[model samples]
Target: MPLPTADTPWPPVDTRVLTSLADWDAWYSAEPERLEQRYEGRGSLEQANRPAQYAGGLRGRLARWFWGQPTPAGEKSSKLHIPLAGDIARTSSGLLFSEPPALISEHQGTQDRLDAMAKSLHPTLLEAGEVCAALGGAYFRVVWDDEVSDRPWIDTVAADRAVPEFRYGRLTAVTFWTVLDSGDTNDRRLFRHLERHEKGRIFHGLYEGSLTALGAARPLADHPDTAPLAAMVDAEGGLDTGAPAHLTASYMPNVRPARAWRHIPSAAYWGQSDFQGIEGLMDALDEAWTSWMRDLQDGRSRIIVGDHLLQSLGPGKGVRWEDRRVYTGLNMLPRAGDPDPITSVQFAIRVKEHADTCAALTEQAARQAGYSASTFGEHGDGQAVTATEIKARERRSLATRARKALYADPALSDILAAQLAVEAGFRFGVTGLDLSVPPKVEFQDSVTEGLGELATTAELLRRAEAASTETLVRMQHPDWDDQQVTAEVAAILGESGRAVSDPTMTGAEGPGTHGSGPVE
Candidate 1:
């Protein structure tokens, strides 16, 4: 598909897609105001008019405490928001990228290139992972600027900013856009820069538009953002990538089968968000925290006294409570059955109940978001545990990590291949590098077992005579390549004086010989 031109609808997304994206983005933002605004925007007149009906429901109750209207006293309600949504996104990213994946290729030159690229791009990939978790998915586009840098780099486009075209569940093309400038007062023009990726080409279009319409196509130079690209584009306003379409850009879903929008064909390709199906739980958590804080605030000790107990200040000034060693007797006497003039009172704060509620809500939210409570520090008895034990406790989190990696691996590999393809096509930094084979992205296990445990396991296997030297070596050093394992095995055999001569060769002795001597 080509880029949008004049008369095209702006953003090019249906209402469902817009709503889904907006909801996910709002939750991921972790801002109370944004959440409240989102709720208000989606709320109905009926919900607004009938406070009792609205506040009776779970979501309504949460809203009432968290981001609803001010309290009855006319003071703004104080709400404490626990940013578990943001934490989940960050944890998702950290699980996948805490230990950088190895981008390996059979070709040495390609390997070197990938290594260098990974070194420079690790942080970007980590950020992309977090965005993917939060936004359902992210687009990886191969971009370059000779003026900025010699080598082309992979750029991440948030899911909201992209209009992707998919065929048979595969990403065929994508149009990435940004609002470059929204013109000042009278004009009220919205200038948008759109870059559409297709087979062997990238189309760049600058549109002078309103919020809802692609008004007219403008020259790329008209906008500062697309001016540099203007010089690089061909006469048709497209840059020739000289590579396969899919190589230029790829869409990485956070998880498979966007369950929330699965019924909508247009949104089927979209990824599942980490915050999906847990918004209410998250809201309830924030509400619980806020209520707890309000308790603390309202529970403070207070003294009730008659106006006579207050000291009078100057004419216009208000009376103040003065802390004095002794108080003078008032002219008026108290009634026989009346209570004392002053009394101190403090409401009991429900500390345990609130803490338990918050903990339960947090655990439920984490679990609903496909993570273990332990992952979010909701474990019982805060004590250190072995890596194996931690893994056992965080199995759900590990499983979630594995699921995300499945979606990330291919997208990462494709973009990396695209990076190499562009590098080779433009002959940027490295030349003659083989692009025949795409790099493999091997994610390291996020949970690392203790070295002692690993050694013990290897020893047990060796004692059982159930594994070979190669297997033991691999168990000890899982990250080592075949060549490294082979070299290490040879060295170990040589040191142990157990090296056997090859019988196939012209040797003076048989297979049992060691250093040309026959075995006793």
Candidate 2:
């Protein structure tokens, strides 16, 4: 076959950035780079045409969307990133957040991808493992799965590029790759070999990595938990065939209200690559993101409202966040009187003007926020609106939108999945991922009355029995102990025996963190 040419199209990218409204228009108008050669689809499909297949919250919706789609074998598939048309609103404060090239989907070439793409969401899916690249290690893939993935992402065969005139819109794109069991799609793997050239350029002004303990090492694309990333890495057992490497990135959802953020980005980072080693990748990202944030903050502090698009120098300066919406969706409800939901500390950078504006609007919204109580209109004292009232209004807005958005679509079974993903991002440290079907969180809680917390059921009892044995041995030998020597020794031996037999570890500090199945 022809050696992969340097002139080949770059690999898939999911980076989301904000360009000036004018610039964004320009980019859209710009000529297509390589598509003229192969894909010549008429711009008929658009995000609007596609149903918002996610709803039960982002996470569960992902699983539903994925499980619902039929994955062709041997490749990893994923939604590059999602774009909400709403963010581009004319809030007059926050600038637009855009993932140029709009939403995207891609496939990774790895063994994990091959296995993940071939199964149904079921109990045995977790123990799934595969070793493809058949004998002679030429062209073959094998997969053995034990657990079903909770969330899955599907991509349409071709994307609809032409969008209507800027009426303000959101876009979410996905990546789909061929899989081992997916006989027909196998031929698509060749397309992945063509995407390597389009990786995002490093921005010395923005840094996503740090030596700090909590810093992010990879972008959302490289995250291990992402089903798409796993499948991609395991494509055709690429590793077995010694394929060039790729990595996944981690993208934490910035659900925090845009107001609380010390800084906000005009756009969010969608995904990244795993090539060139973690350290090198980190090195390239660190300085750039850091500086970009700083600059945005520097410029945001001074907002001369009226009629203008926002801009920023970076972080750590004058940003009018009061006017920005912040991620109002992420605000937390801390207590009864406190205003504003406890938003996430992770902030992105936008402009100083945007910051101040966000801050002001948040305060206005908070002050105007309604609440509930025995009484409704008790005039006089300026004791801000009742929490119940505010919630009522918010709920109304949400309900109205839900009626229209896919959030309430009964047709798709992803509502639960989407809700889970959104919950995980907020509750757990997890972002949107193709979570495996919970596999039944069957908790054999110690409440099994007869078990008596004495090491509880099998696992815990075994541990307690073992500990008792040591105490008994010490007692049996007076010189080494306390209580009745011989009798205690007998009891200790008995407990020890039971421990060996049952082998329980109830109430032990905690069990292993790895999954029940062996590591691949």
Judging by TM-score against the true structure, name the best candidate. 1
Q: Tens digits of per-residue lDDT for model 2 on 360-431?
A: 433332222111111122222565554444445344332322222221121112322332333344223344
Which parts of model 1 are misplaced by more than 4 Å?
Answer: 42-74, 182-187, 314-318, 324-335, 426-430, 468-471, 479-520
Local distance difference test values of all predictions, in order: 0.82, 0.25
Task: Spell out the clash pairs found in candidate 1.
Answer: none
Q: Pick by lDDT: which candidate is best?
A: 1
Clashes of 2: 164
Instruction: Give each model a TM-score.
Output: 0.87, 0.18
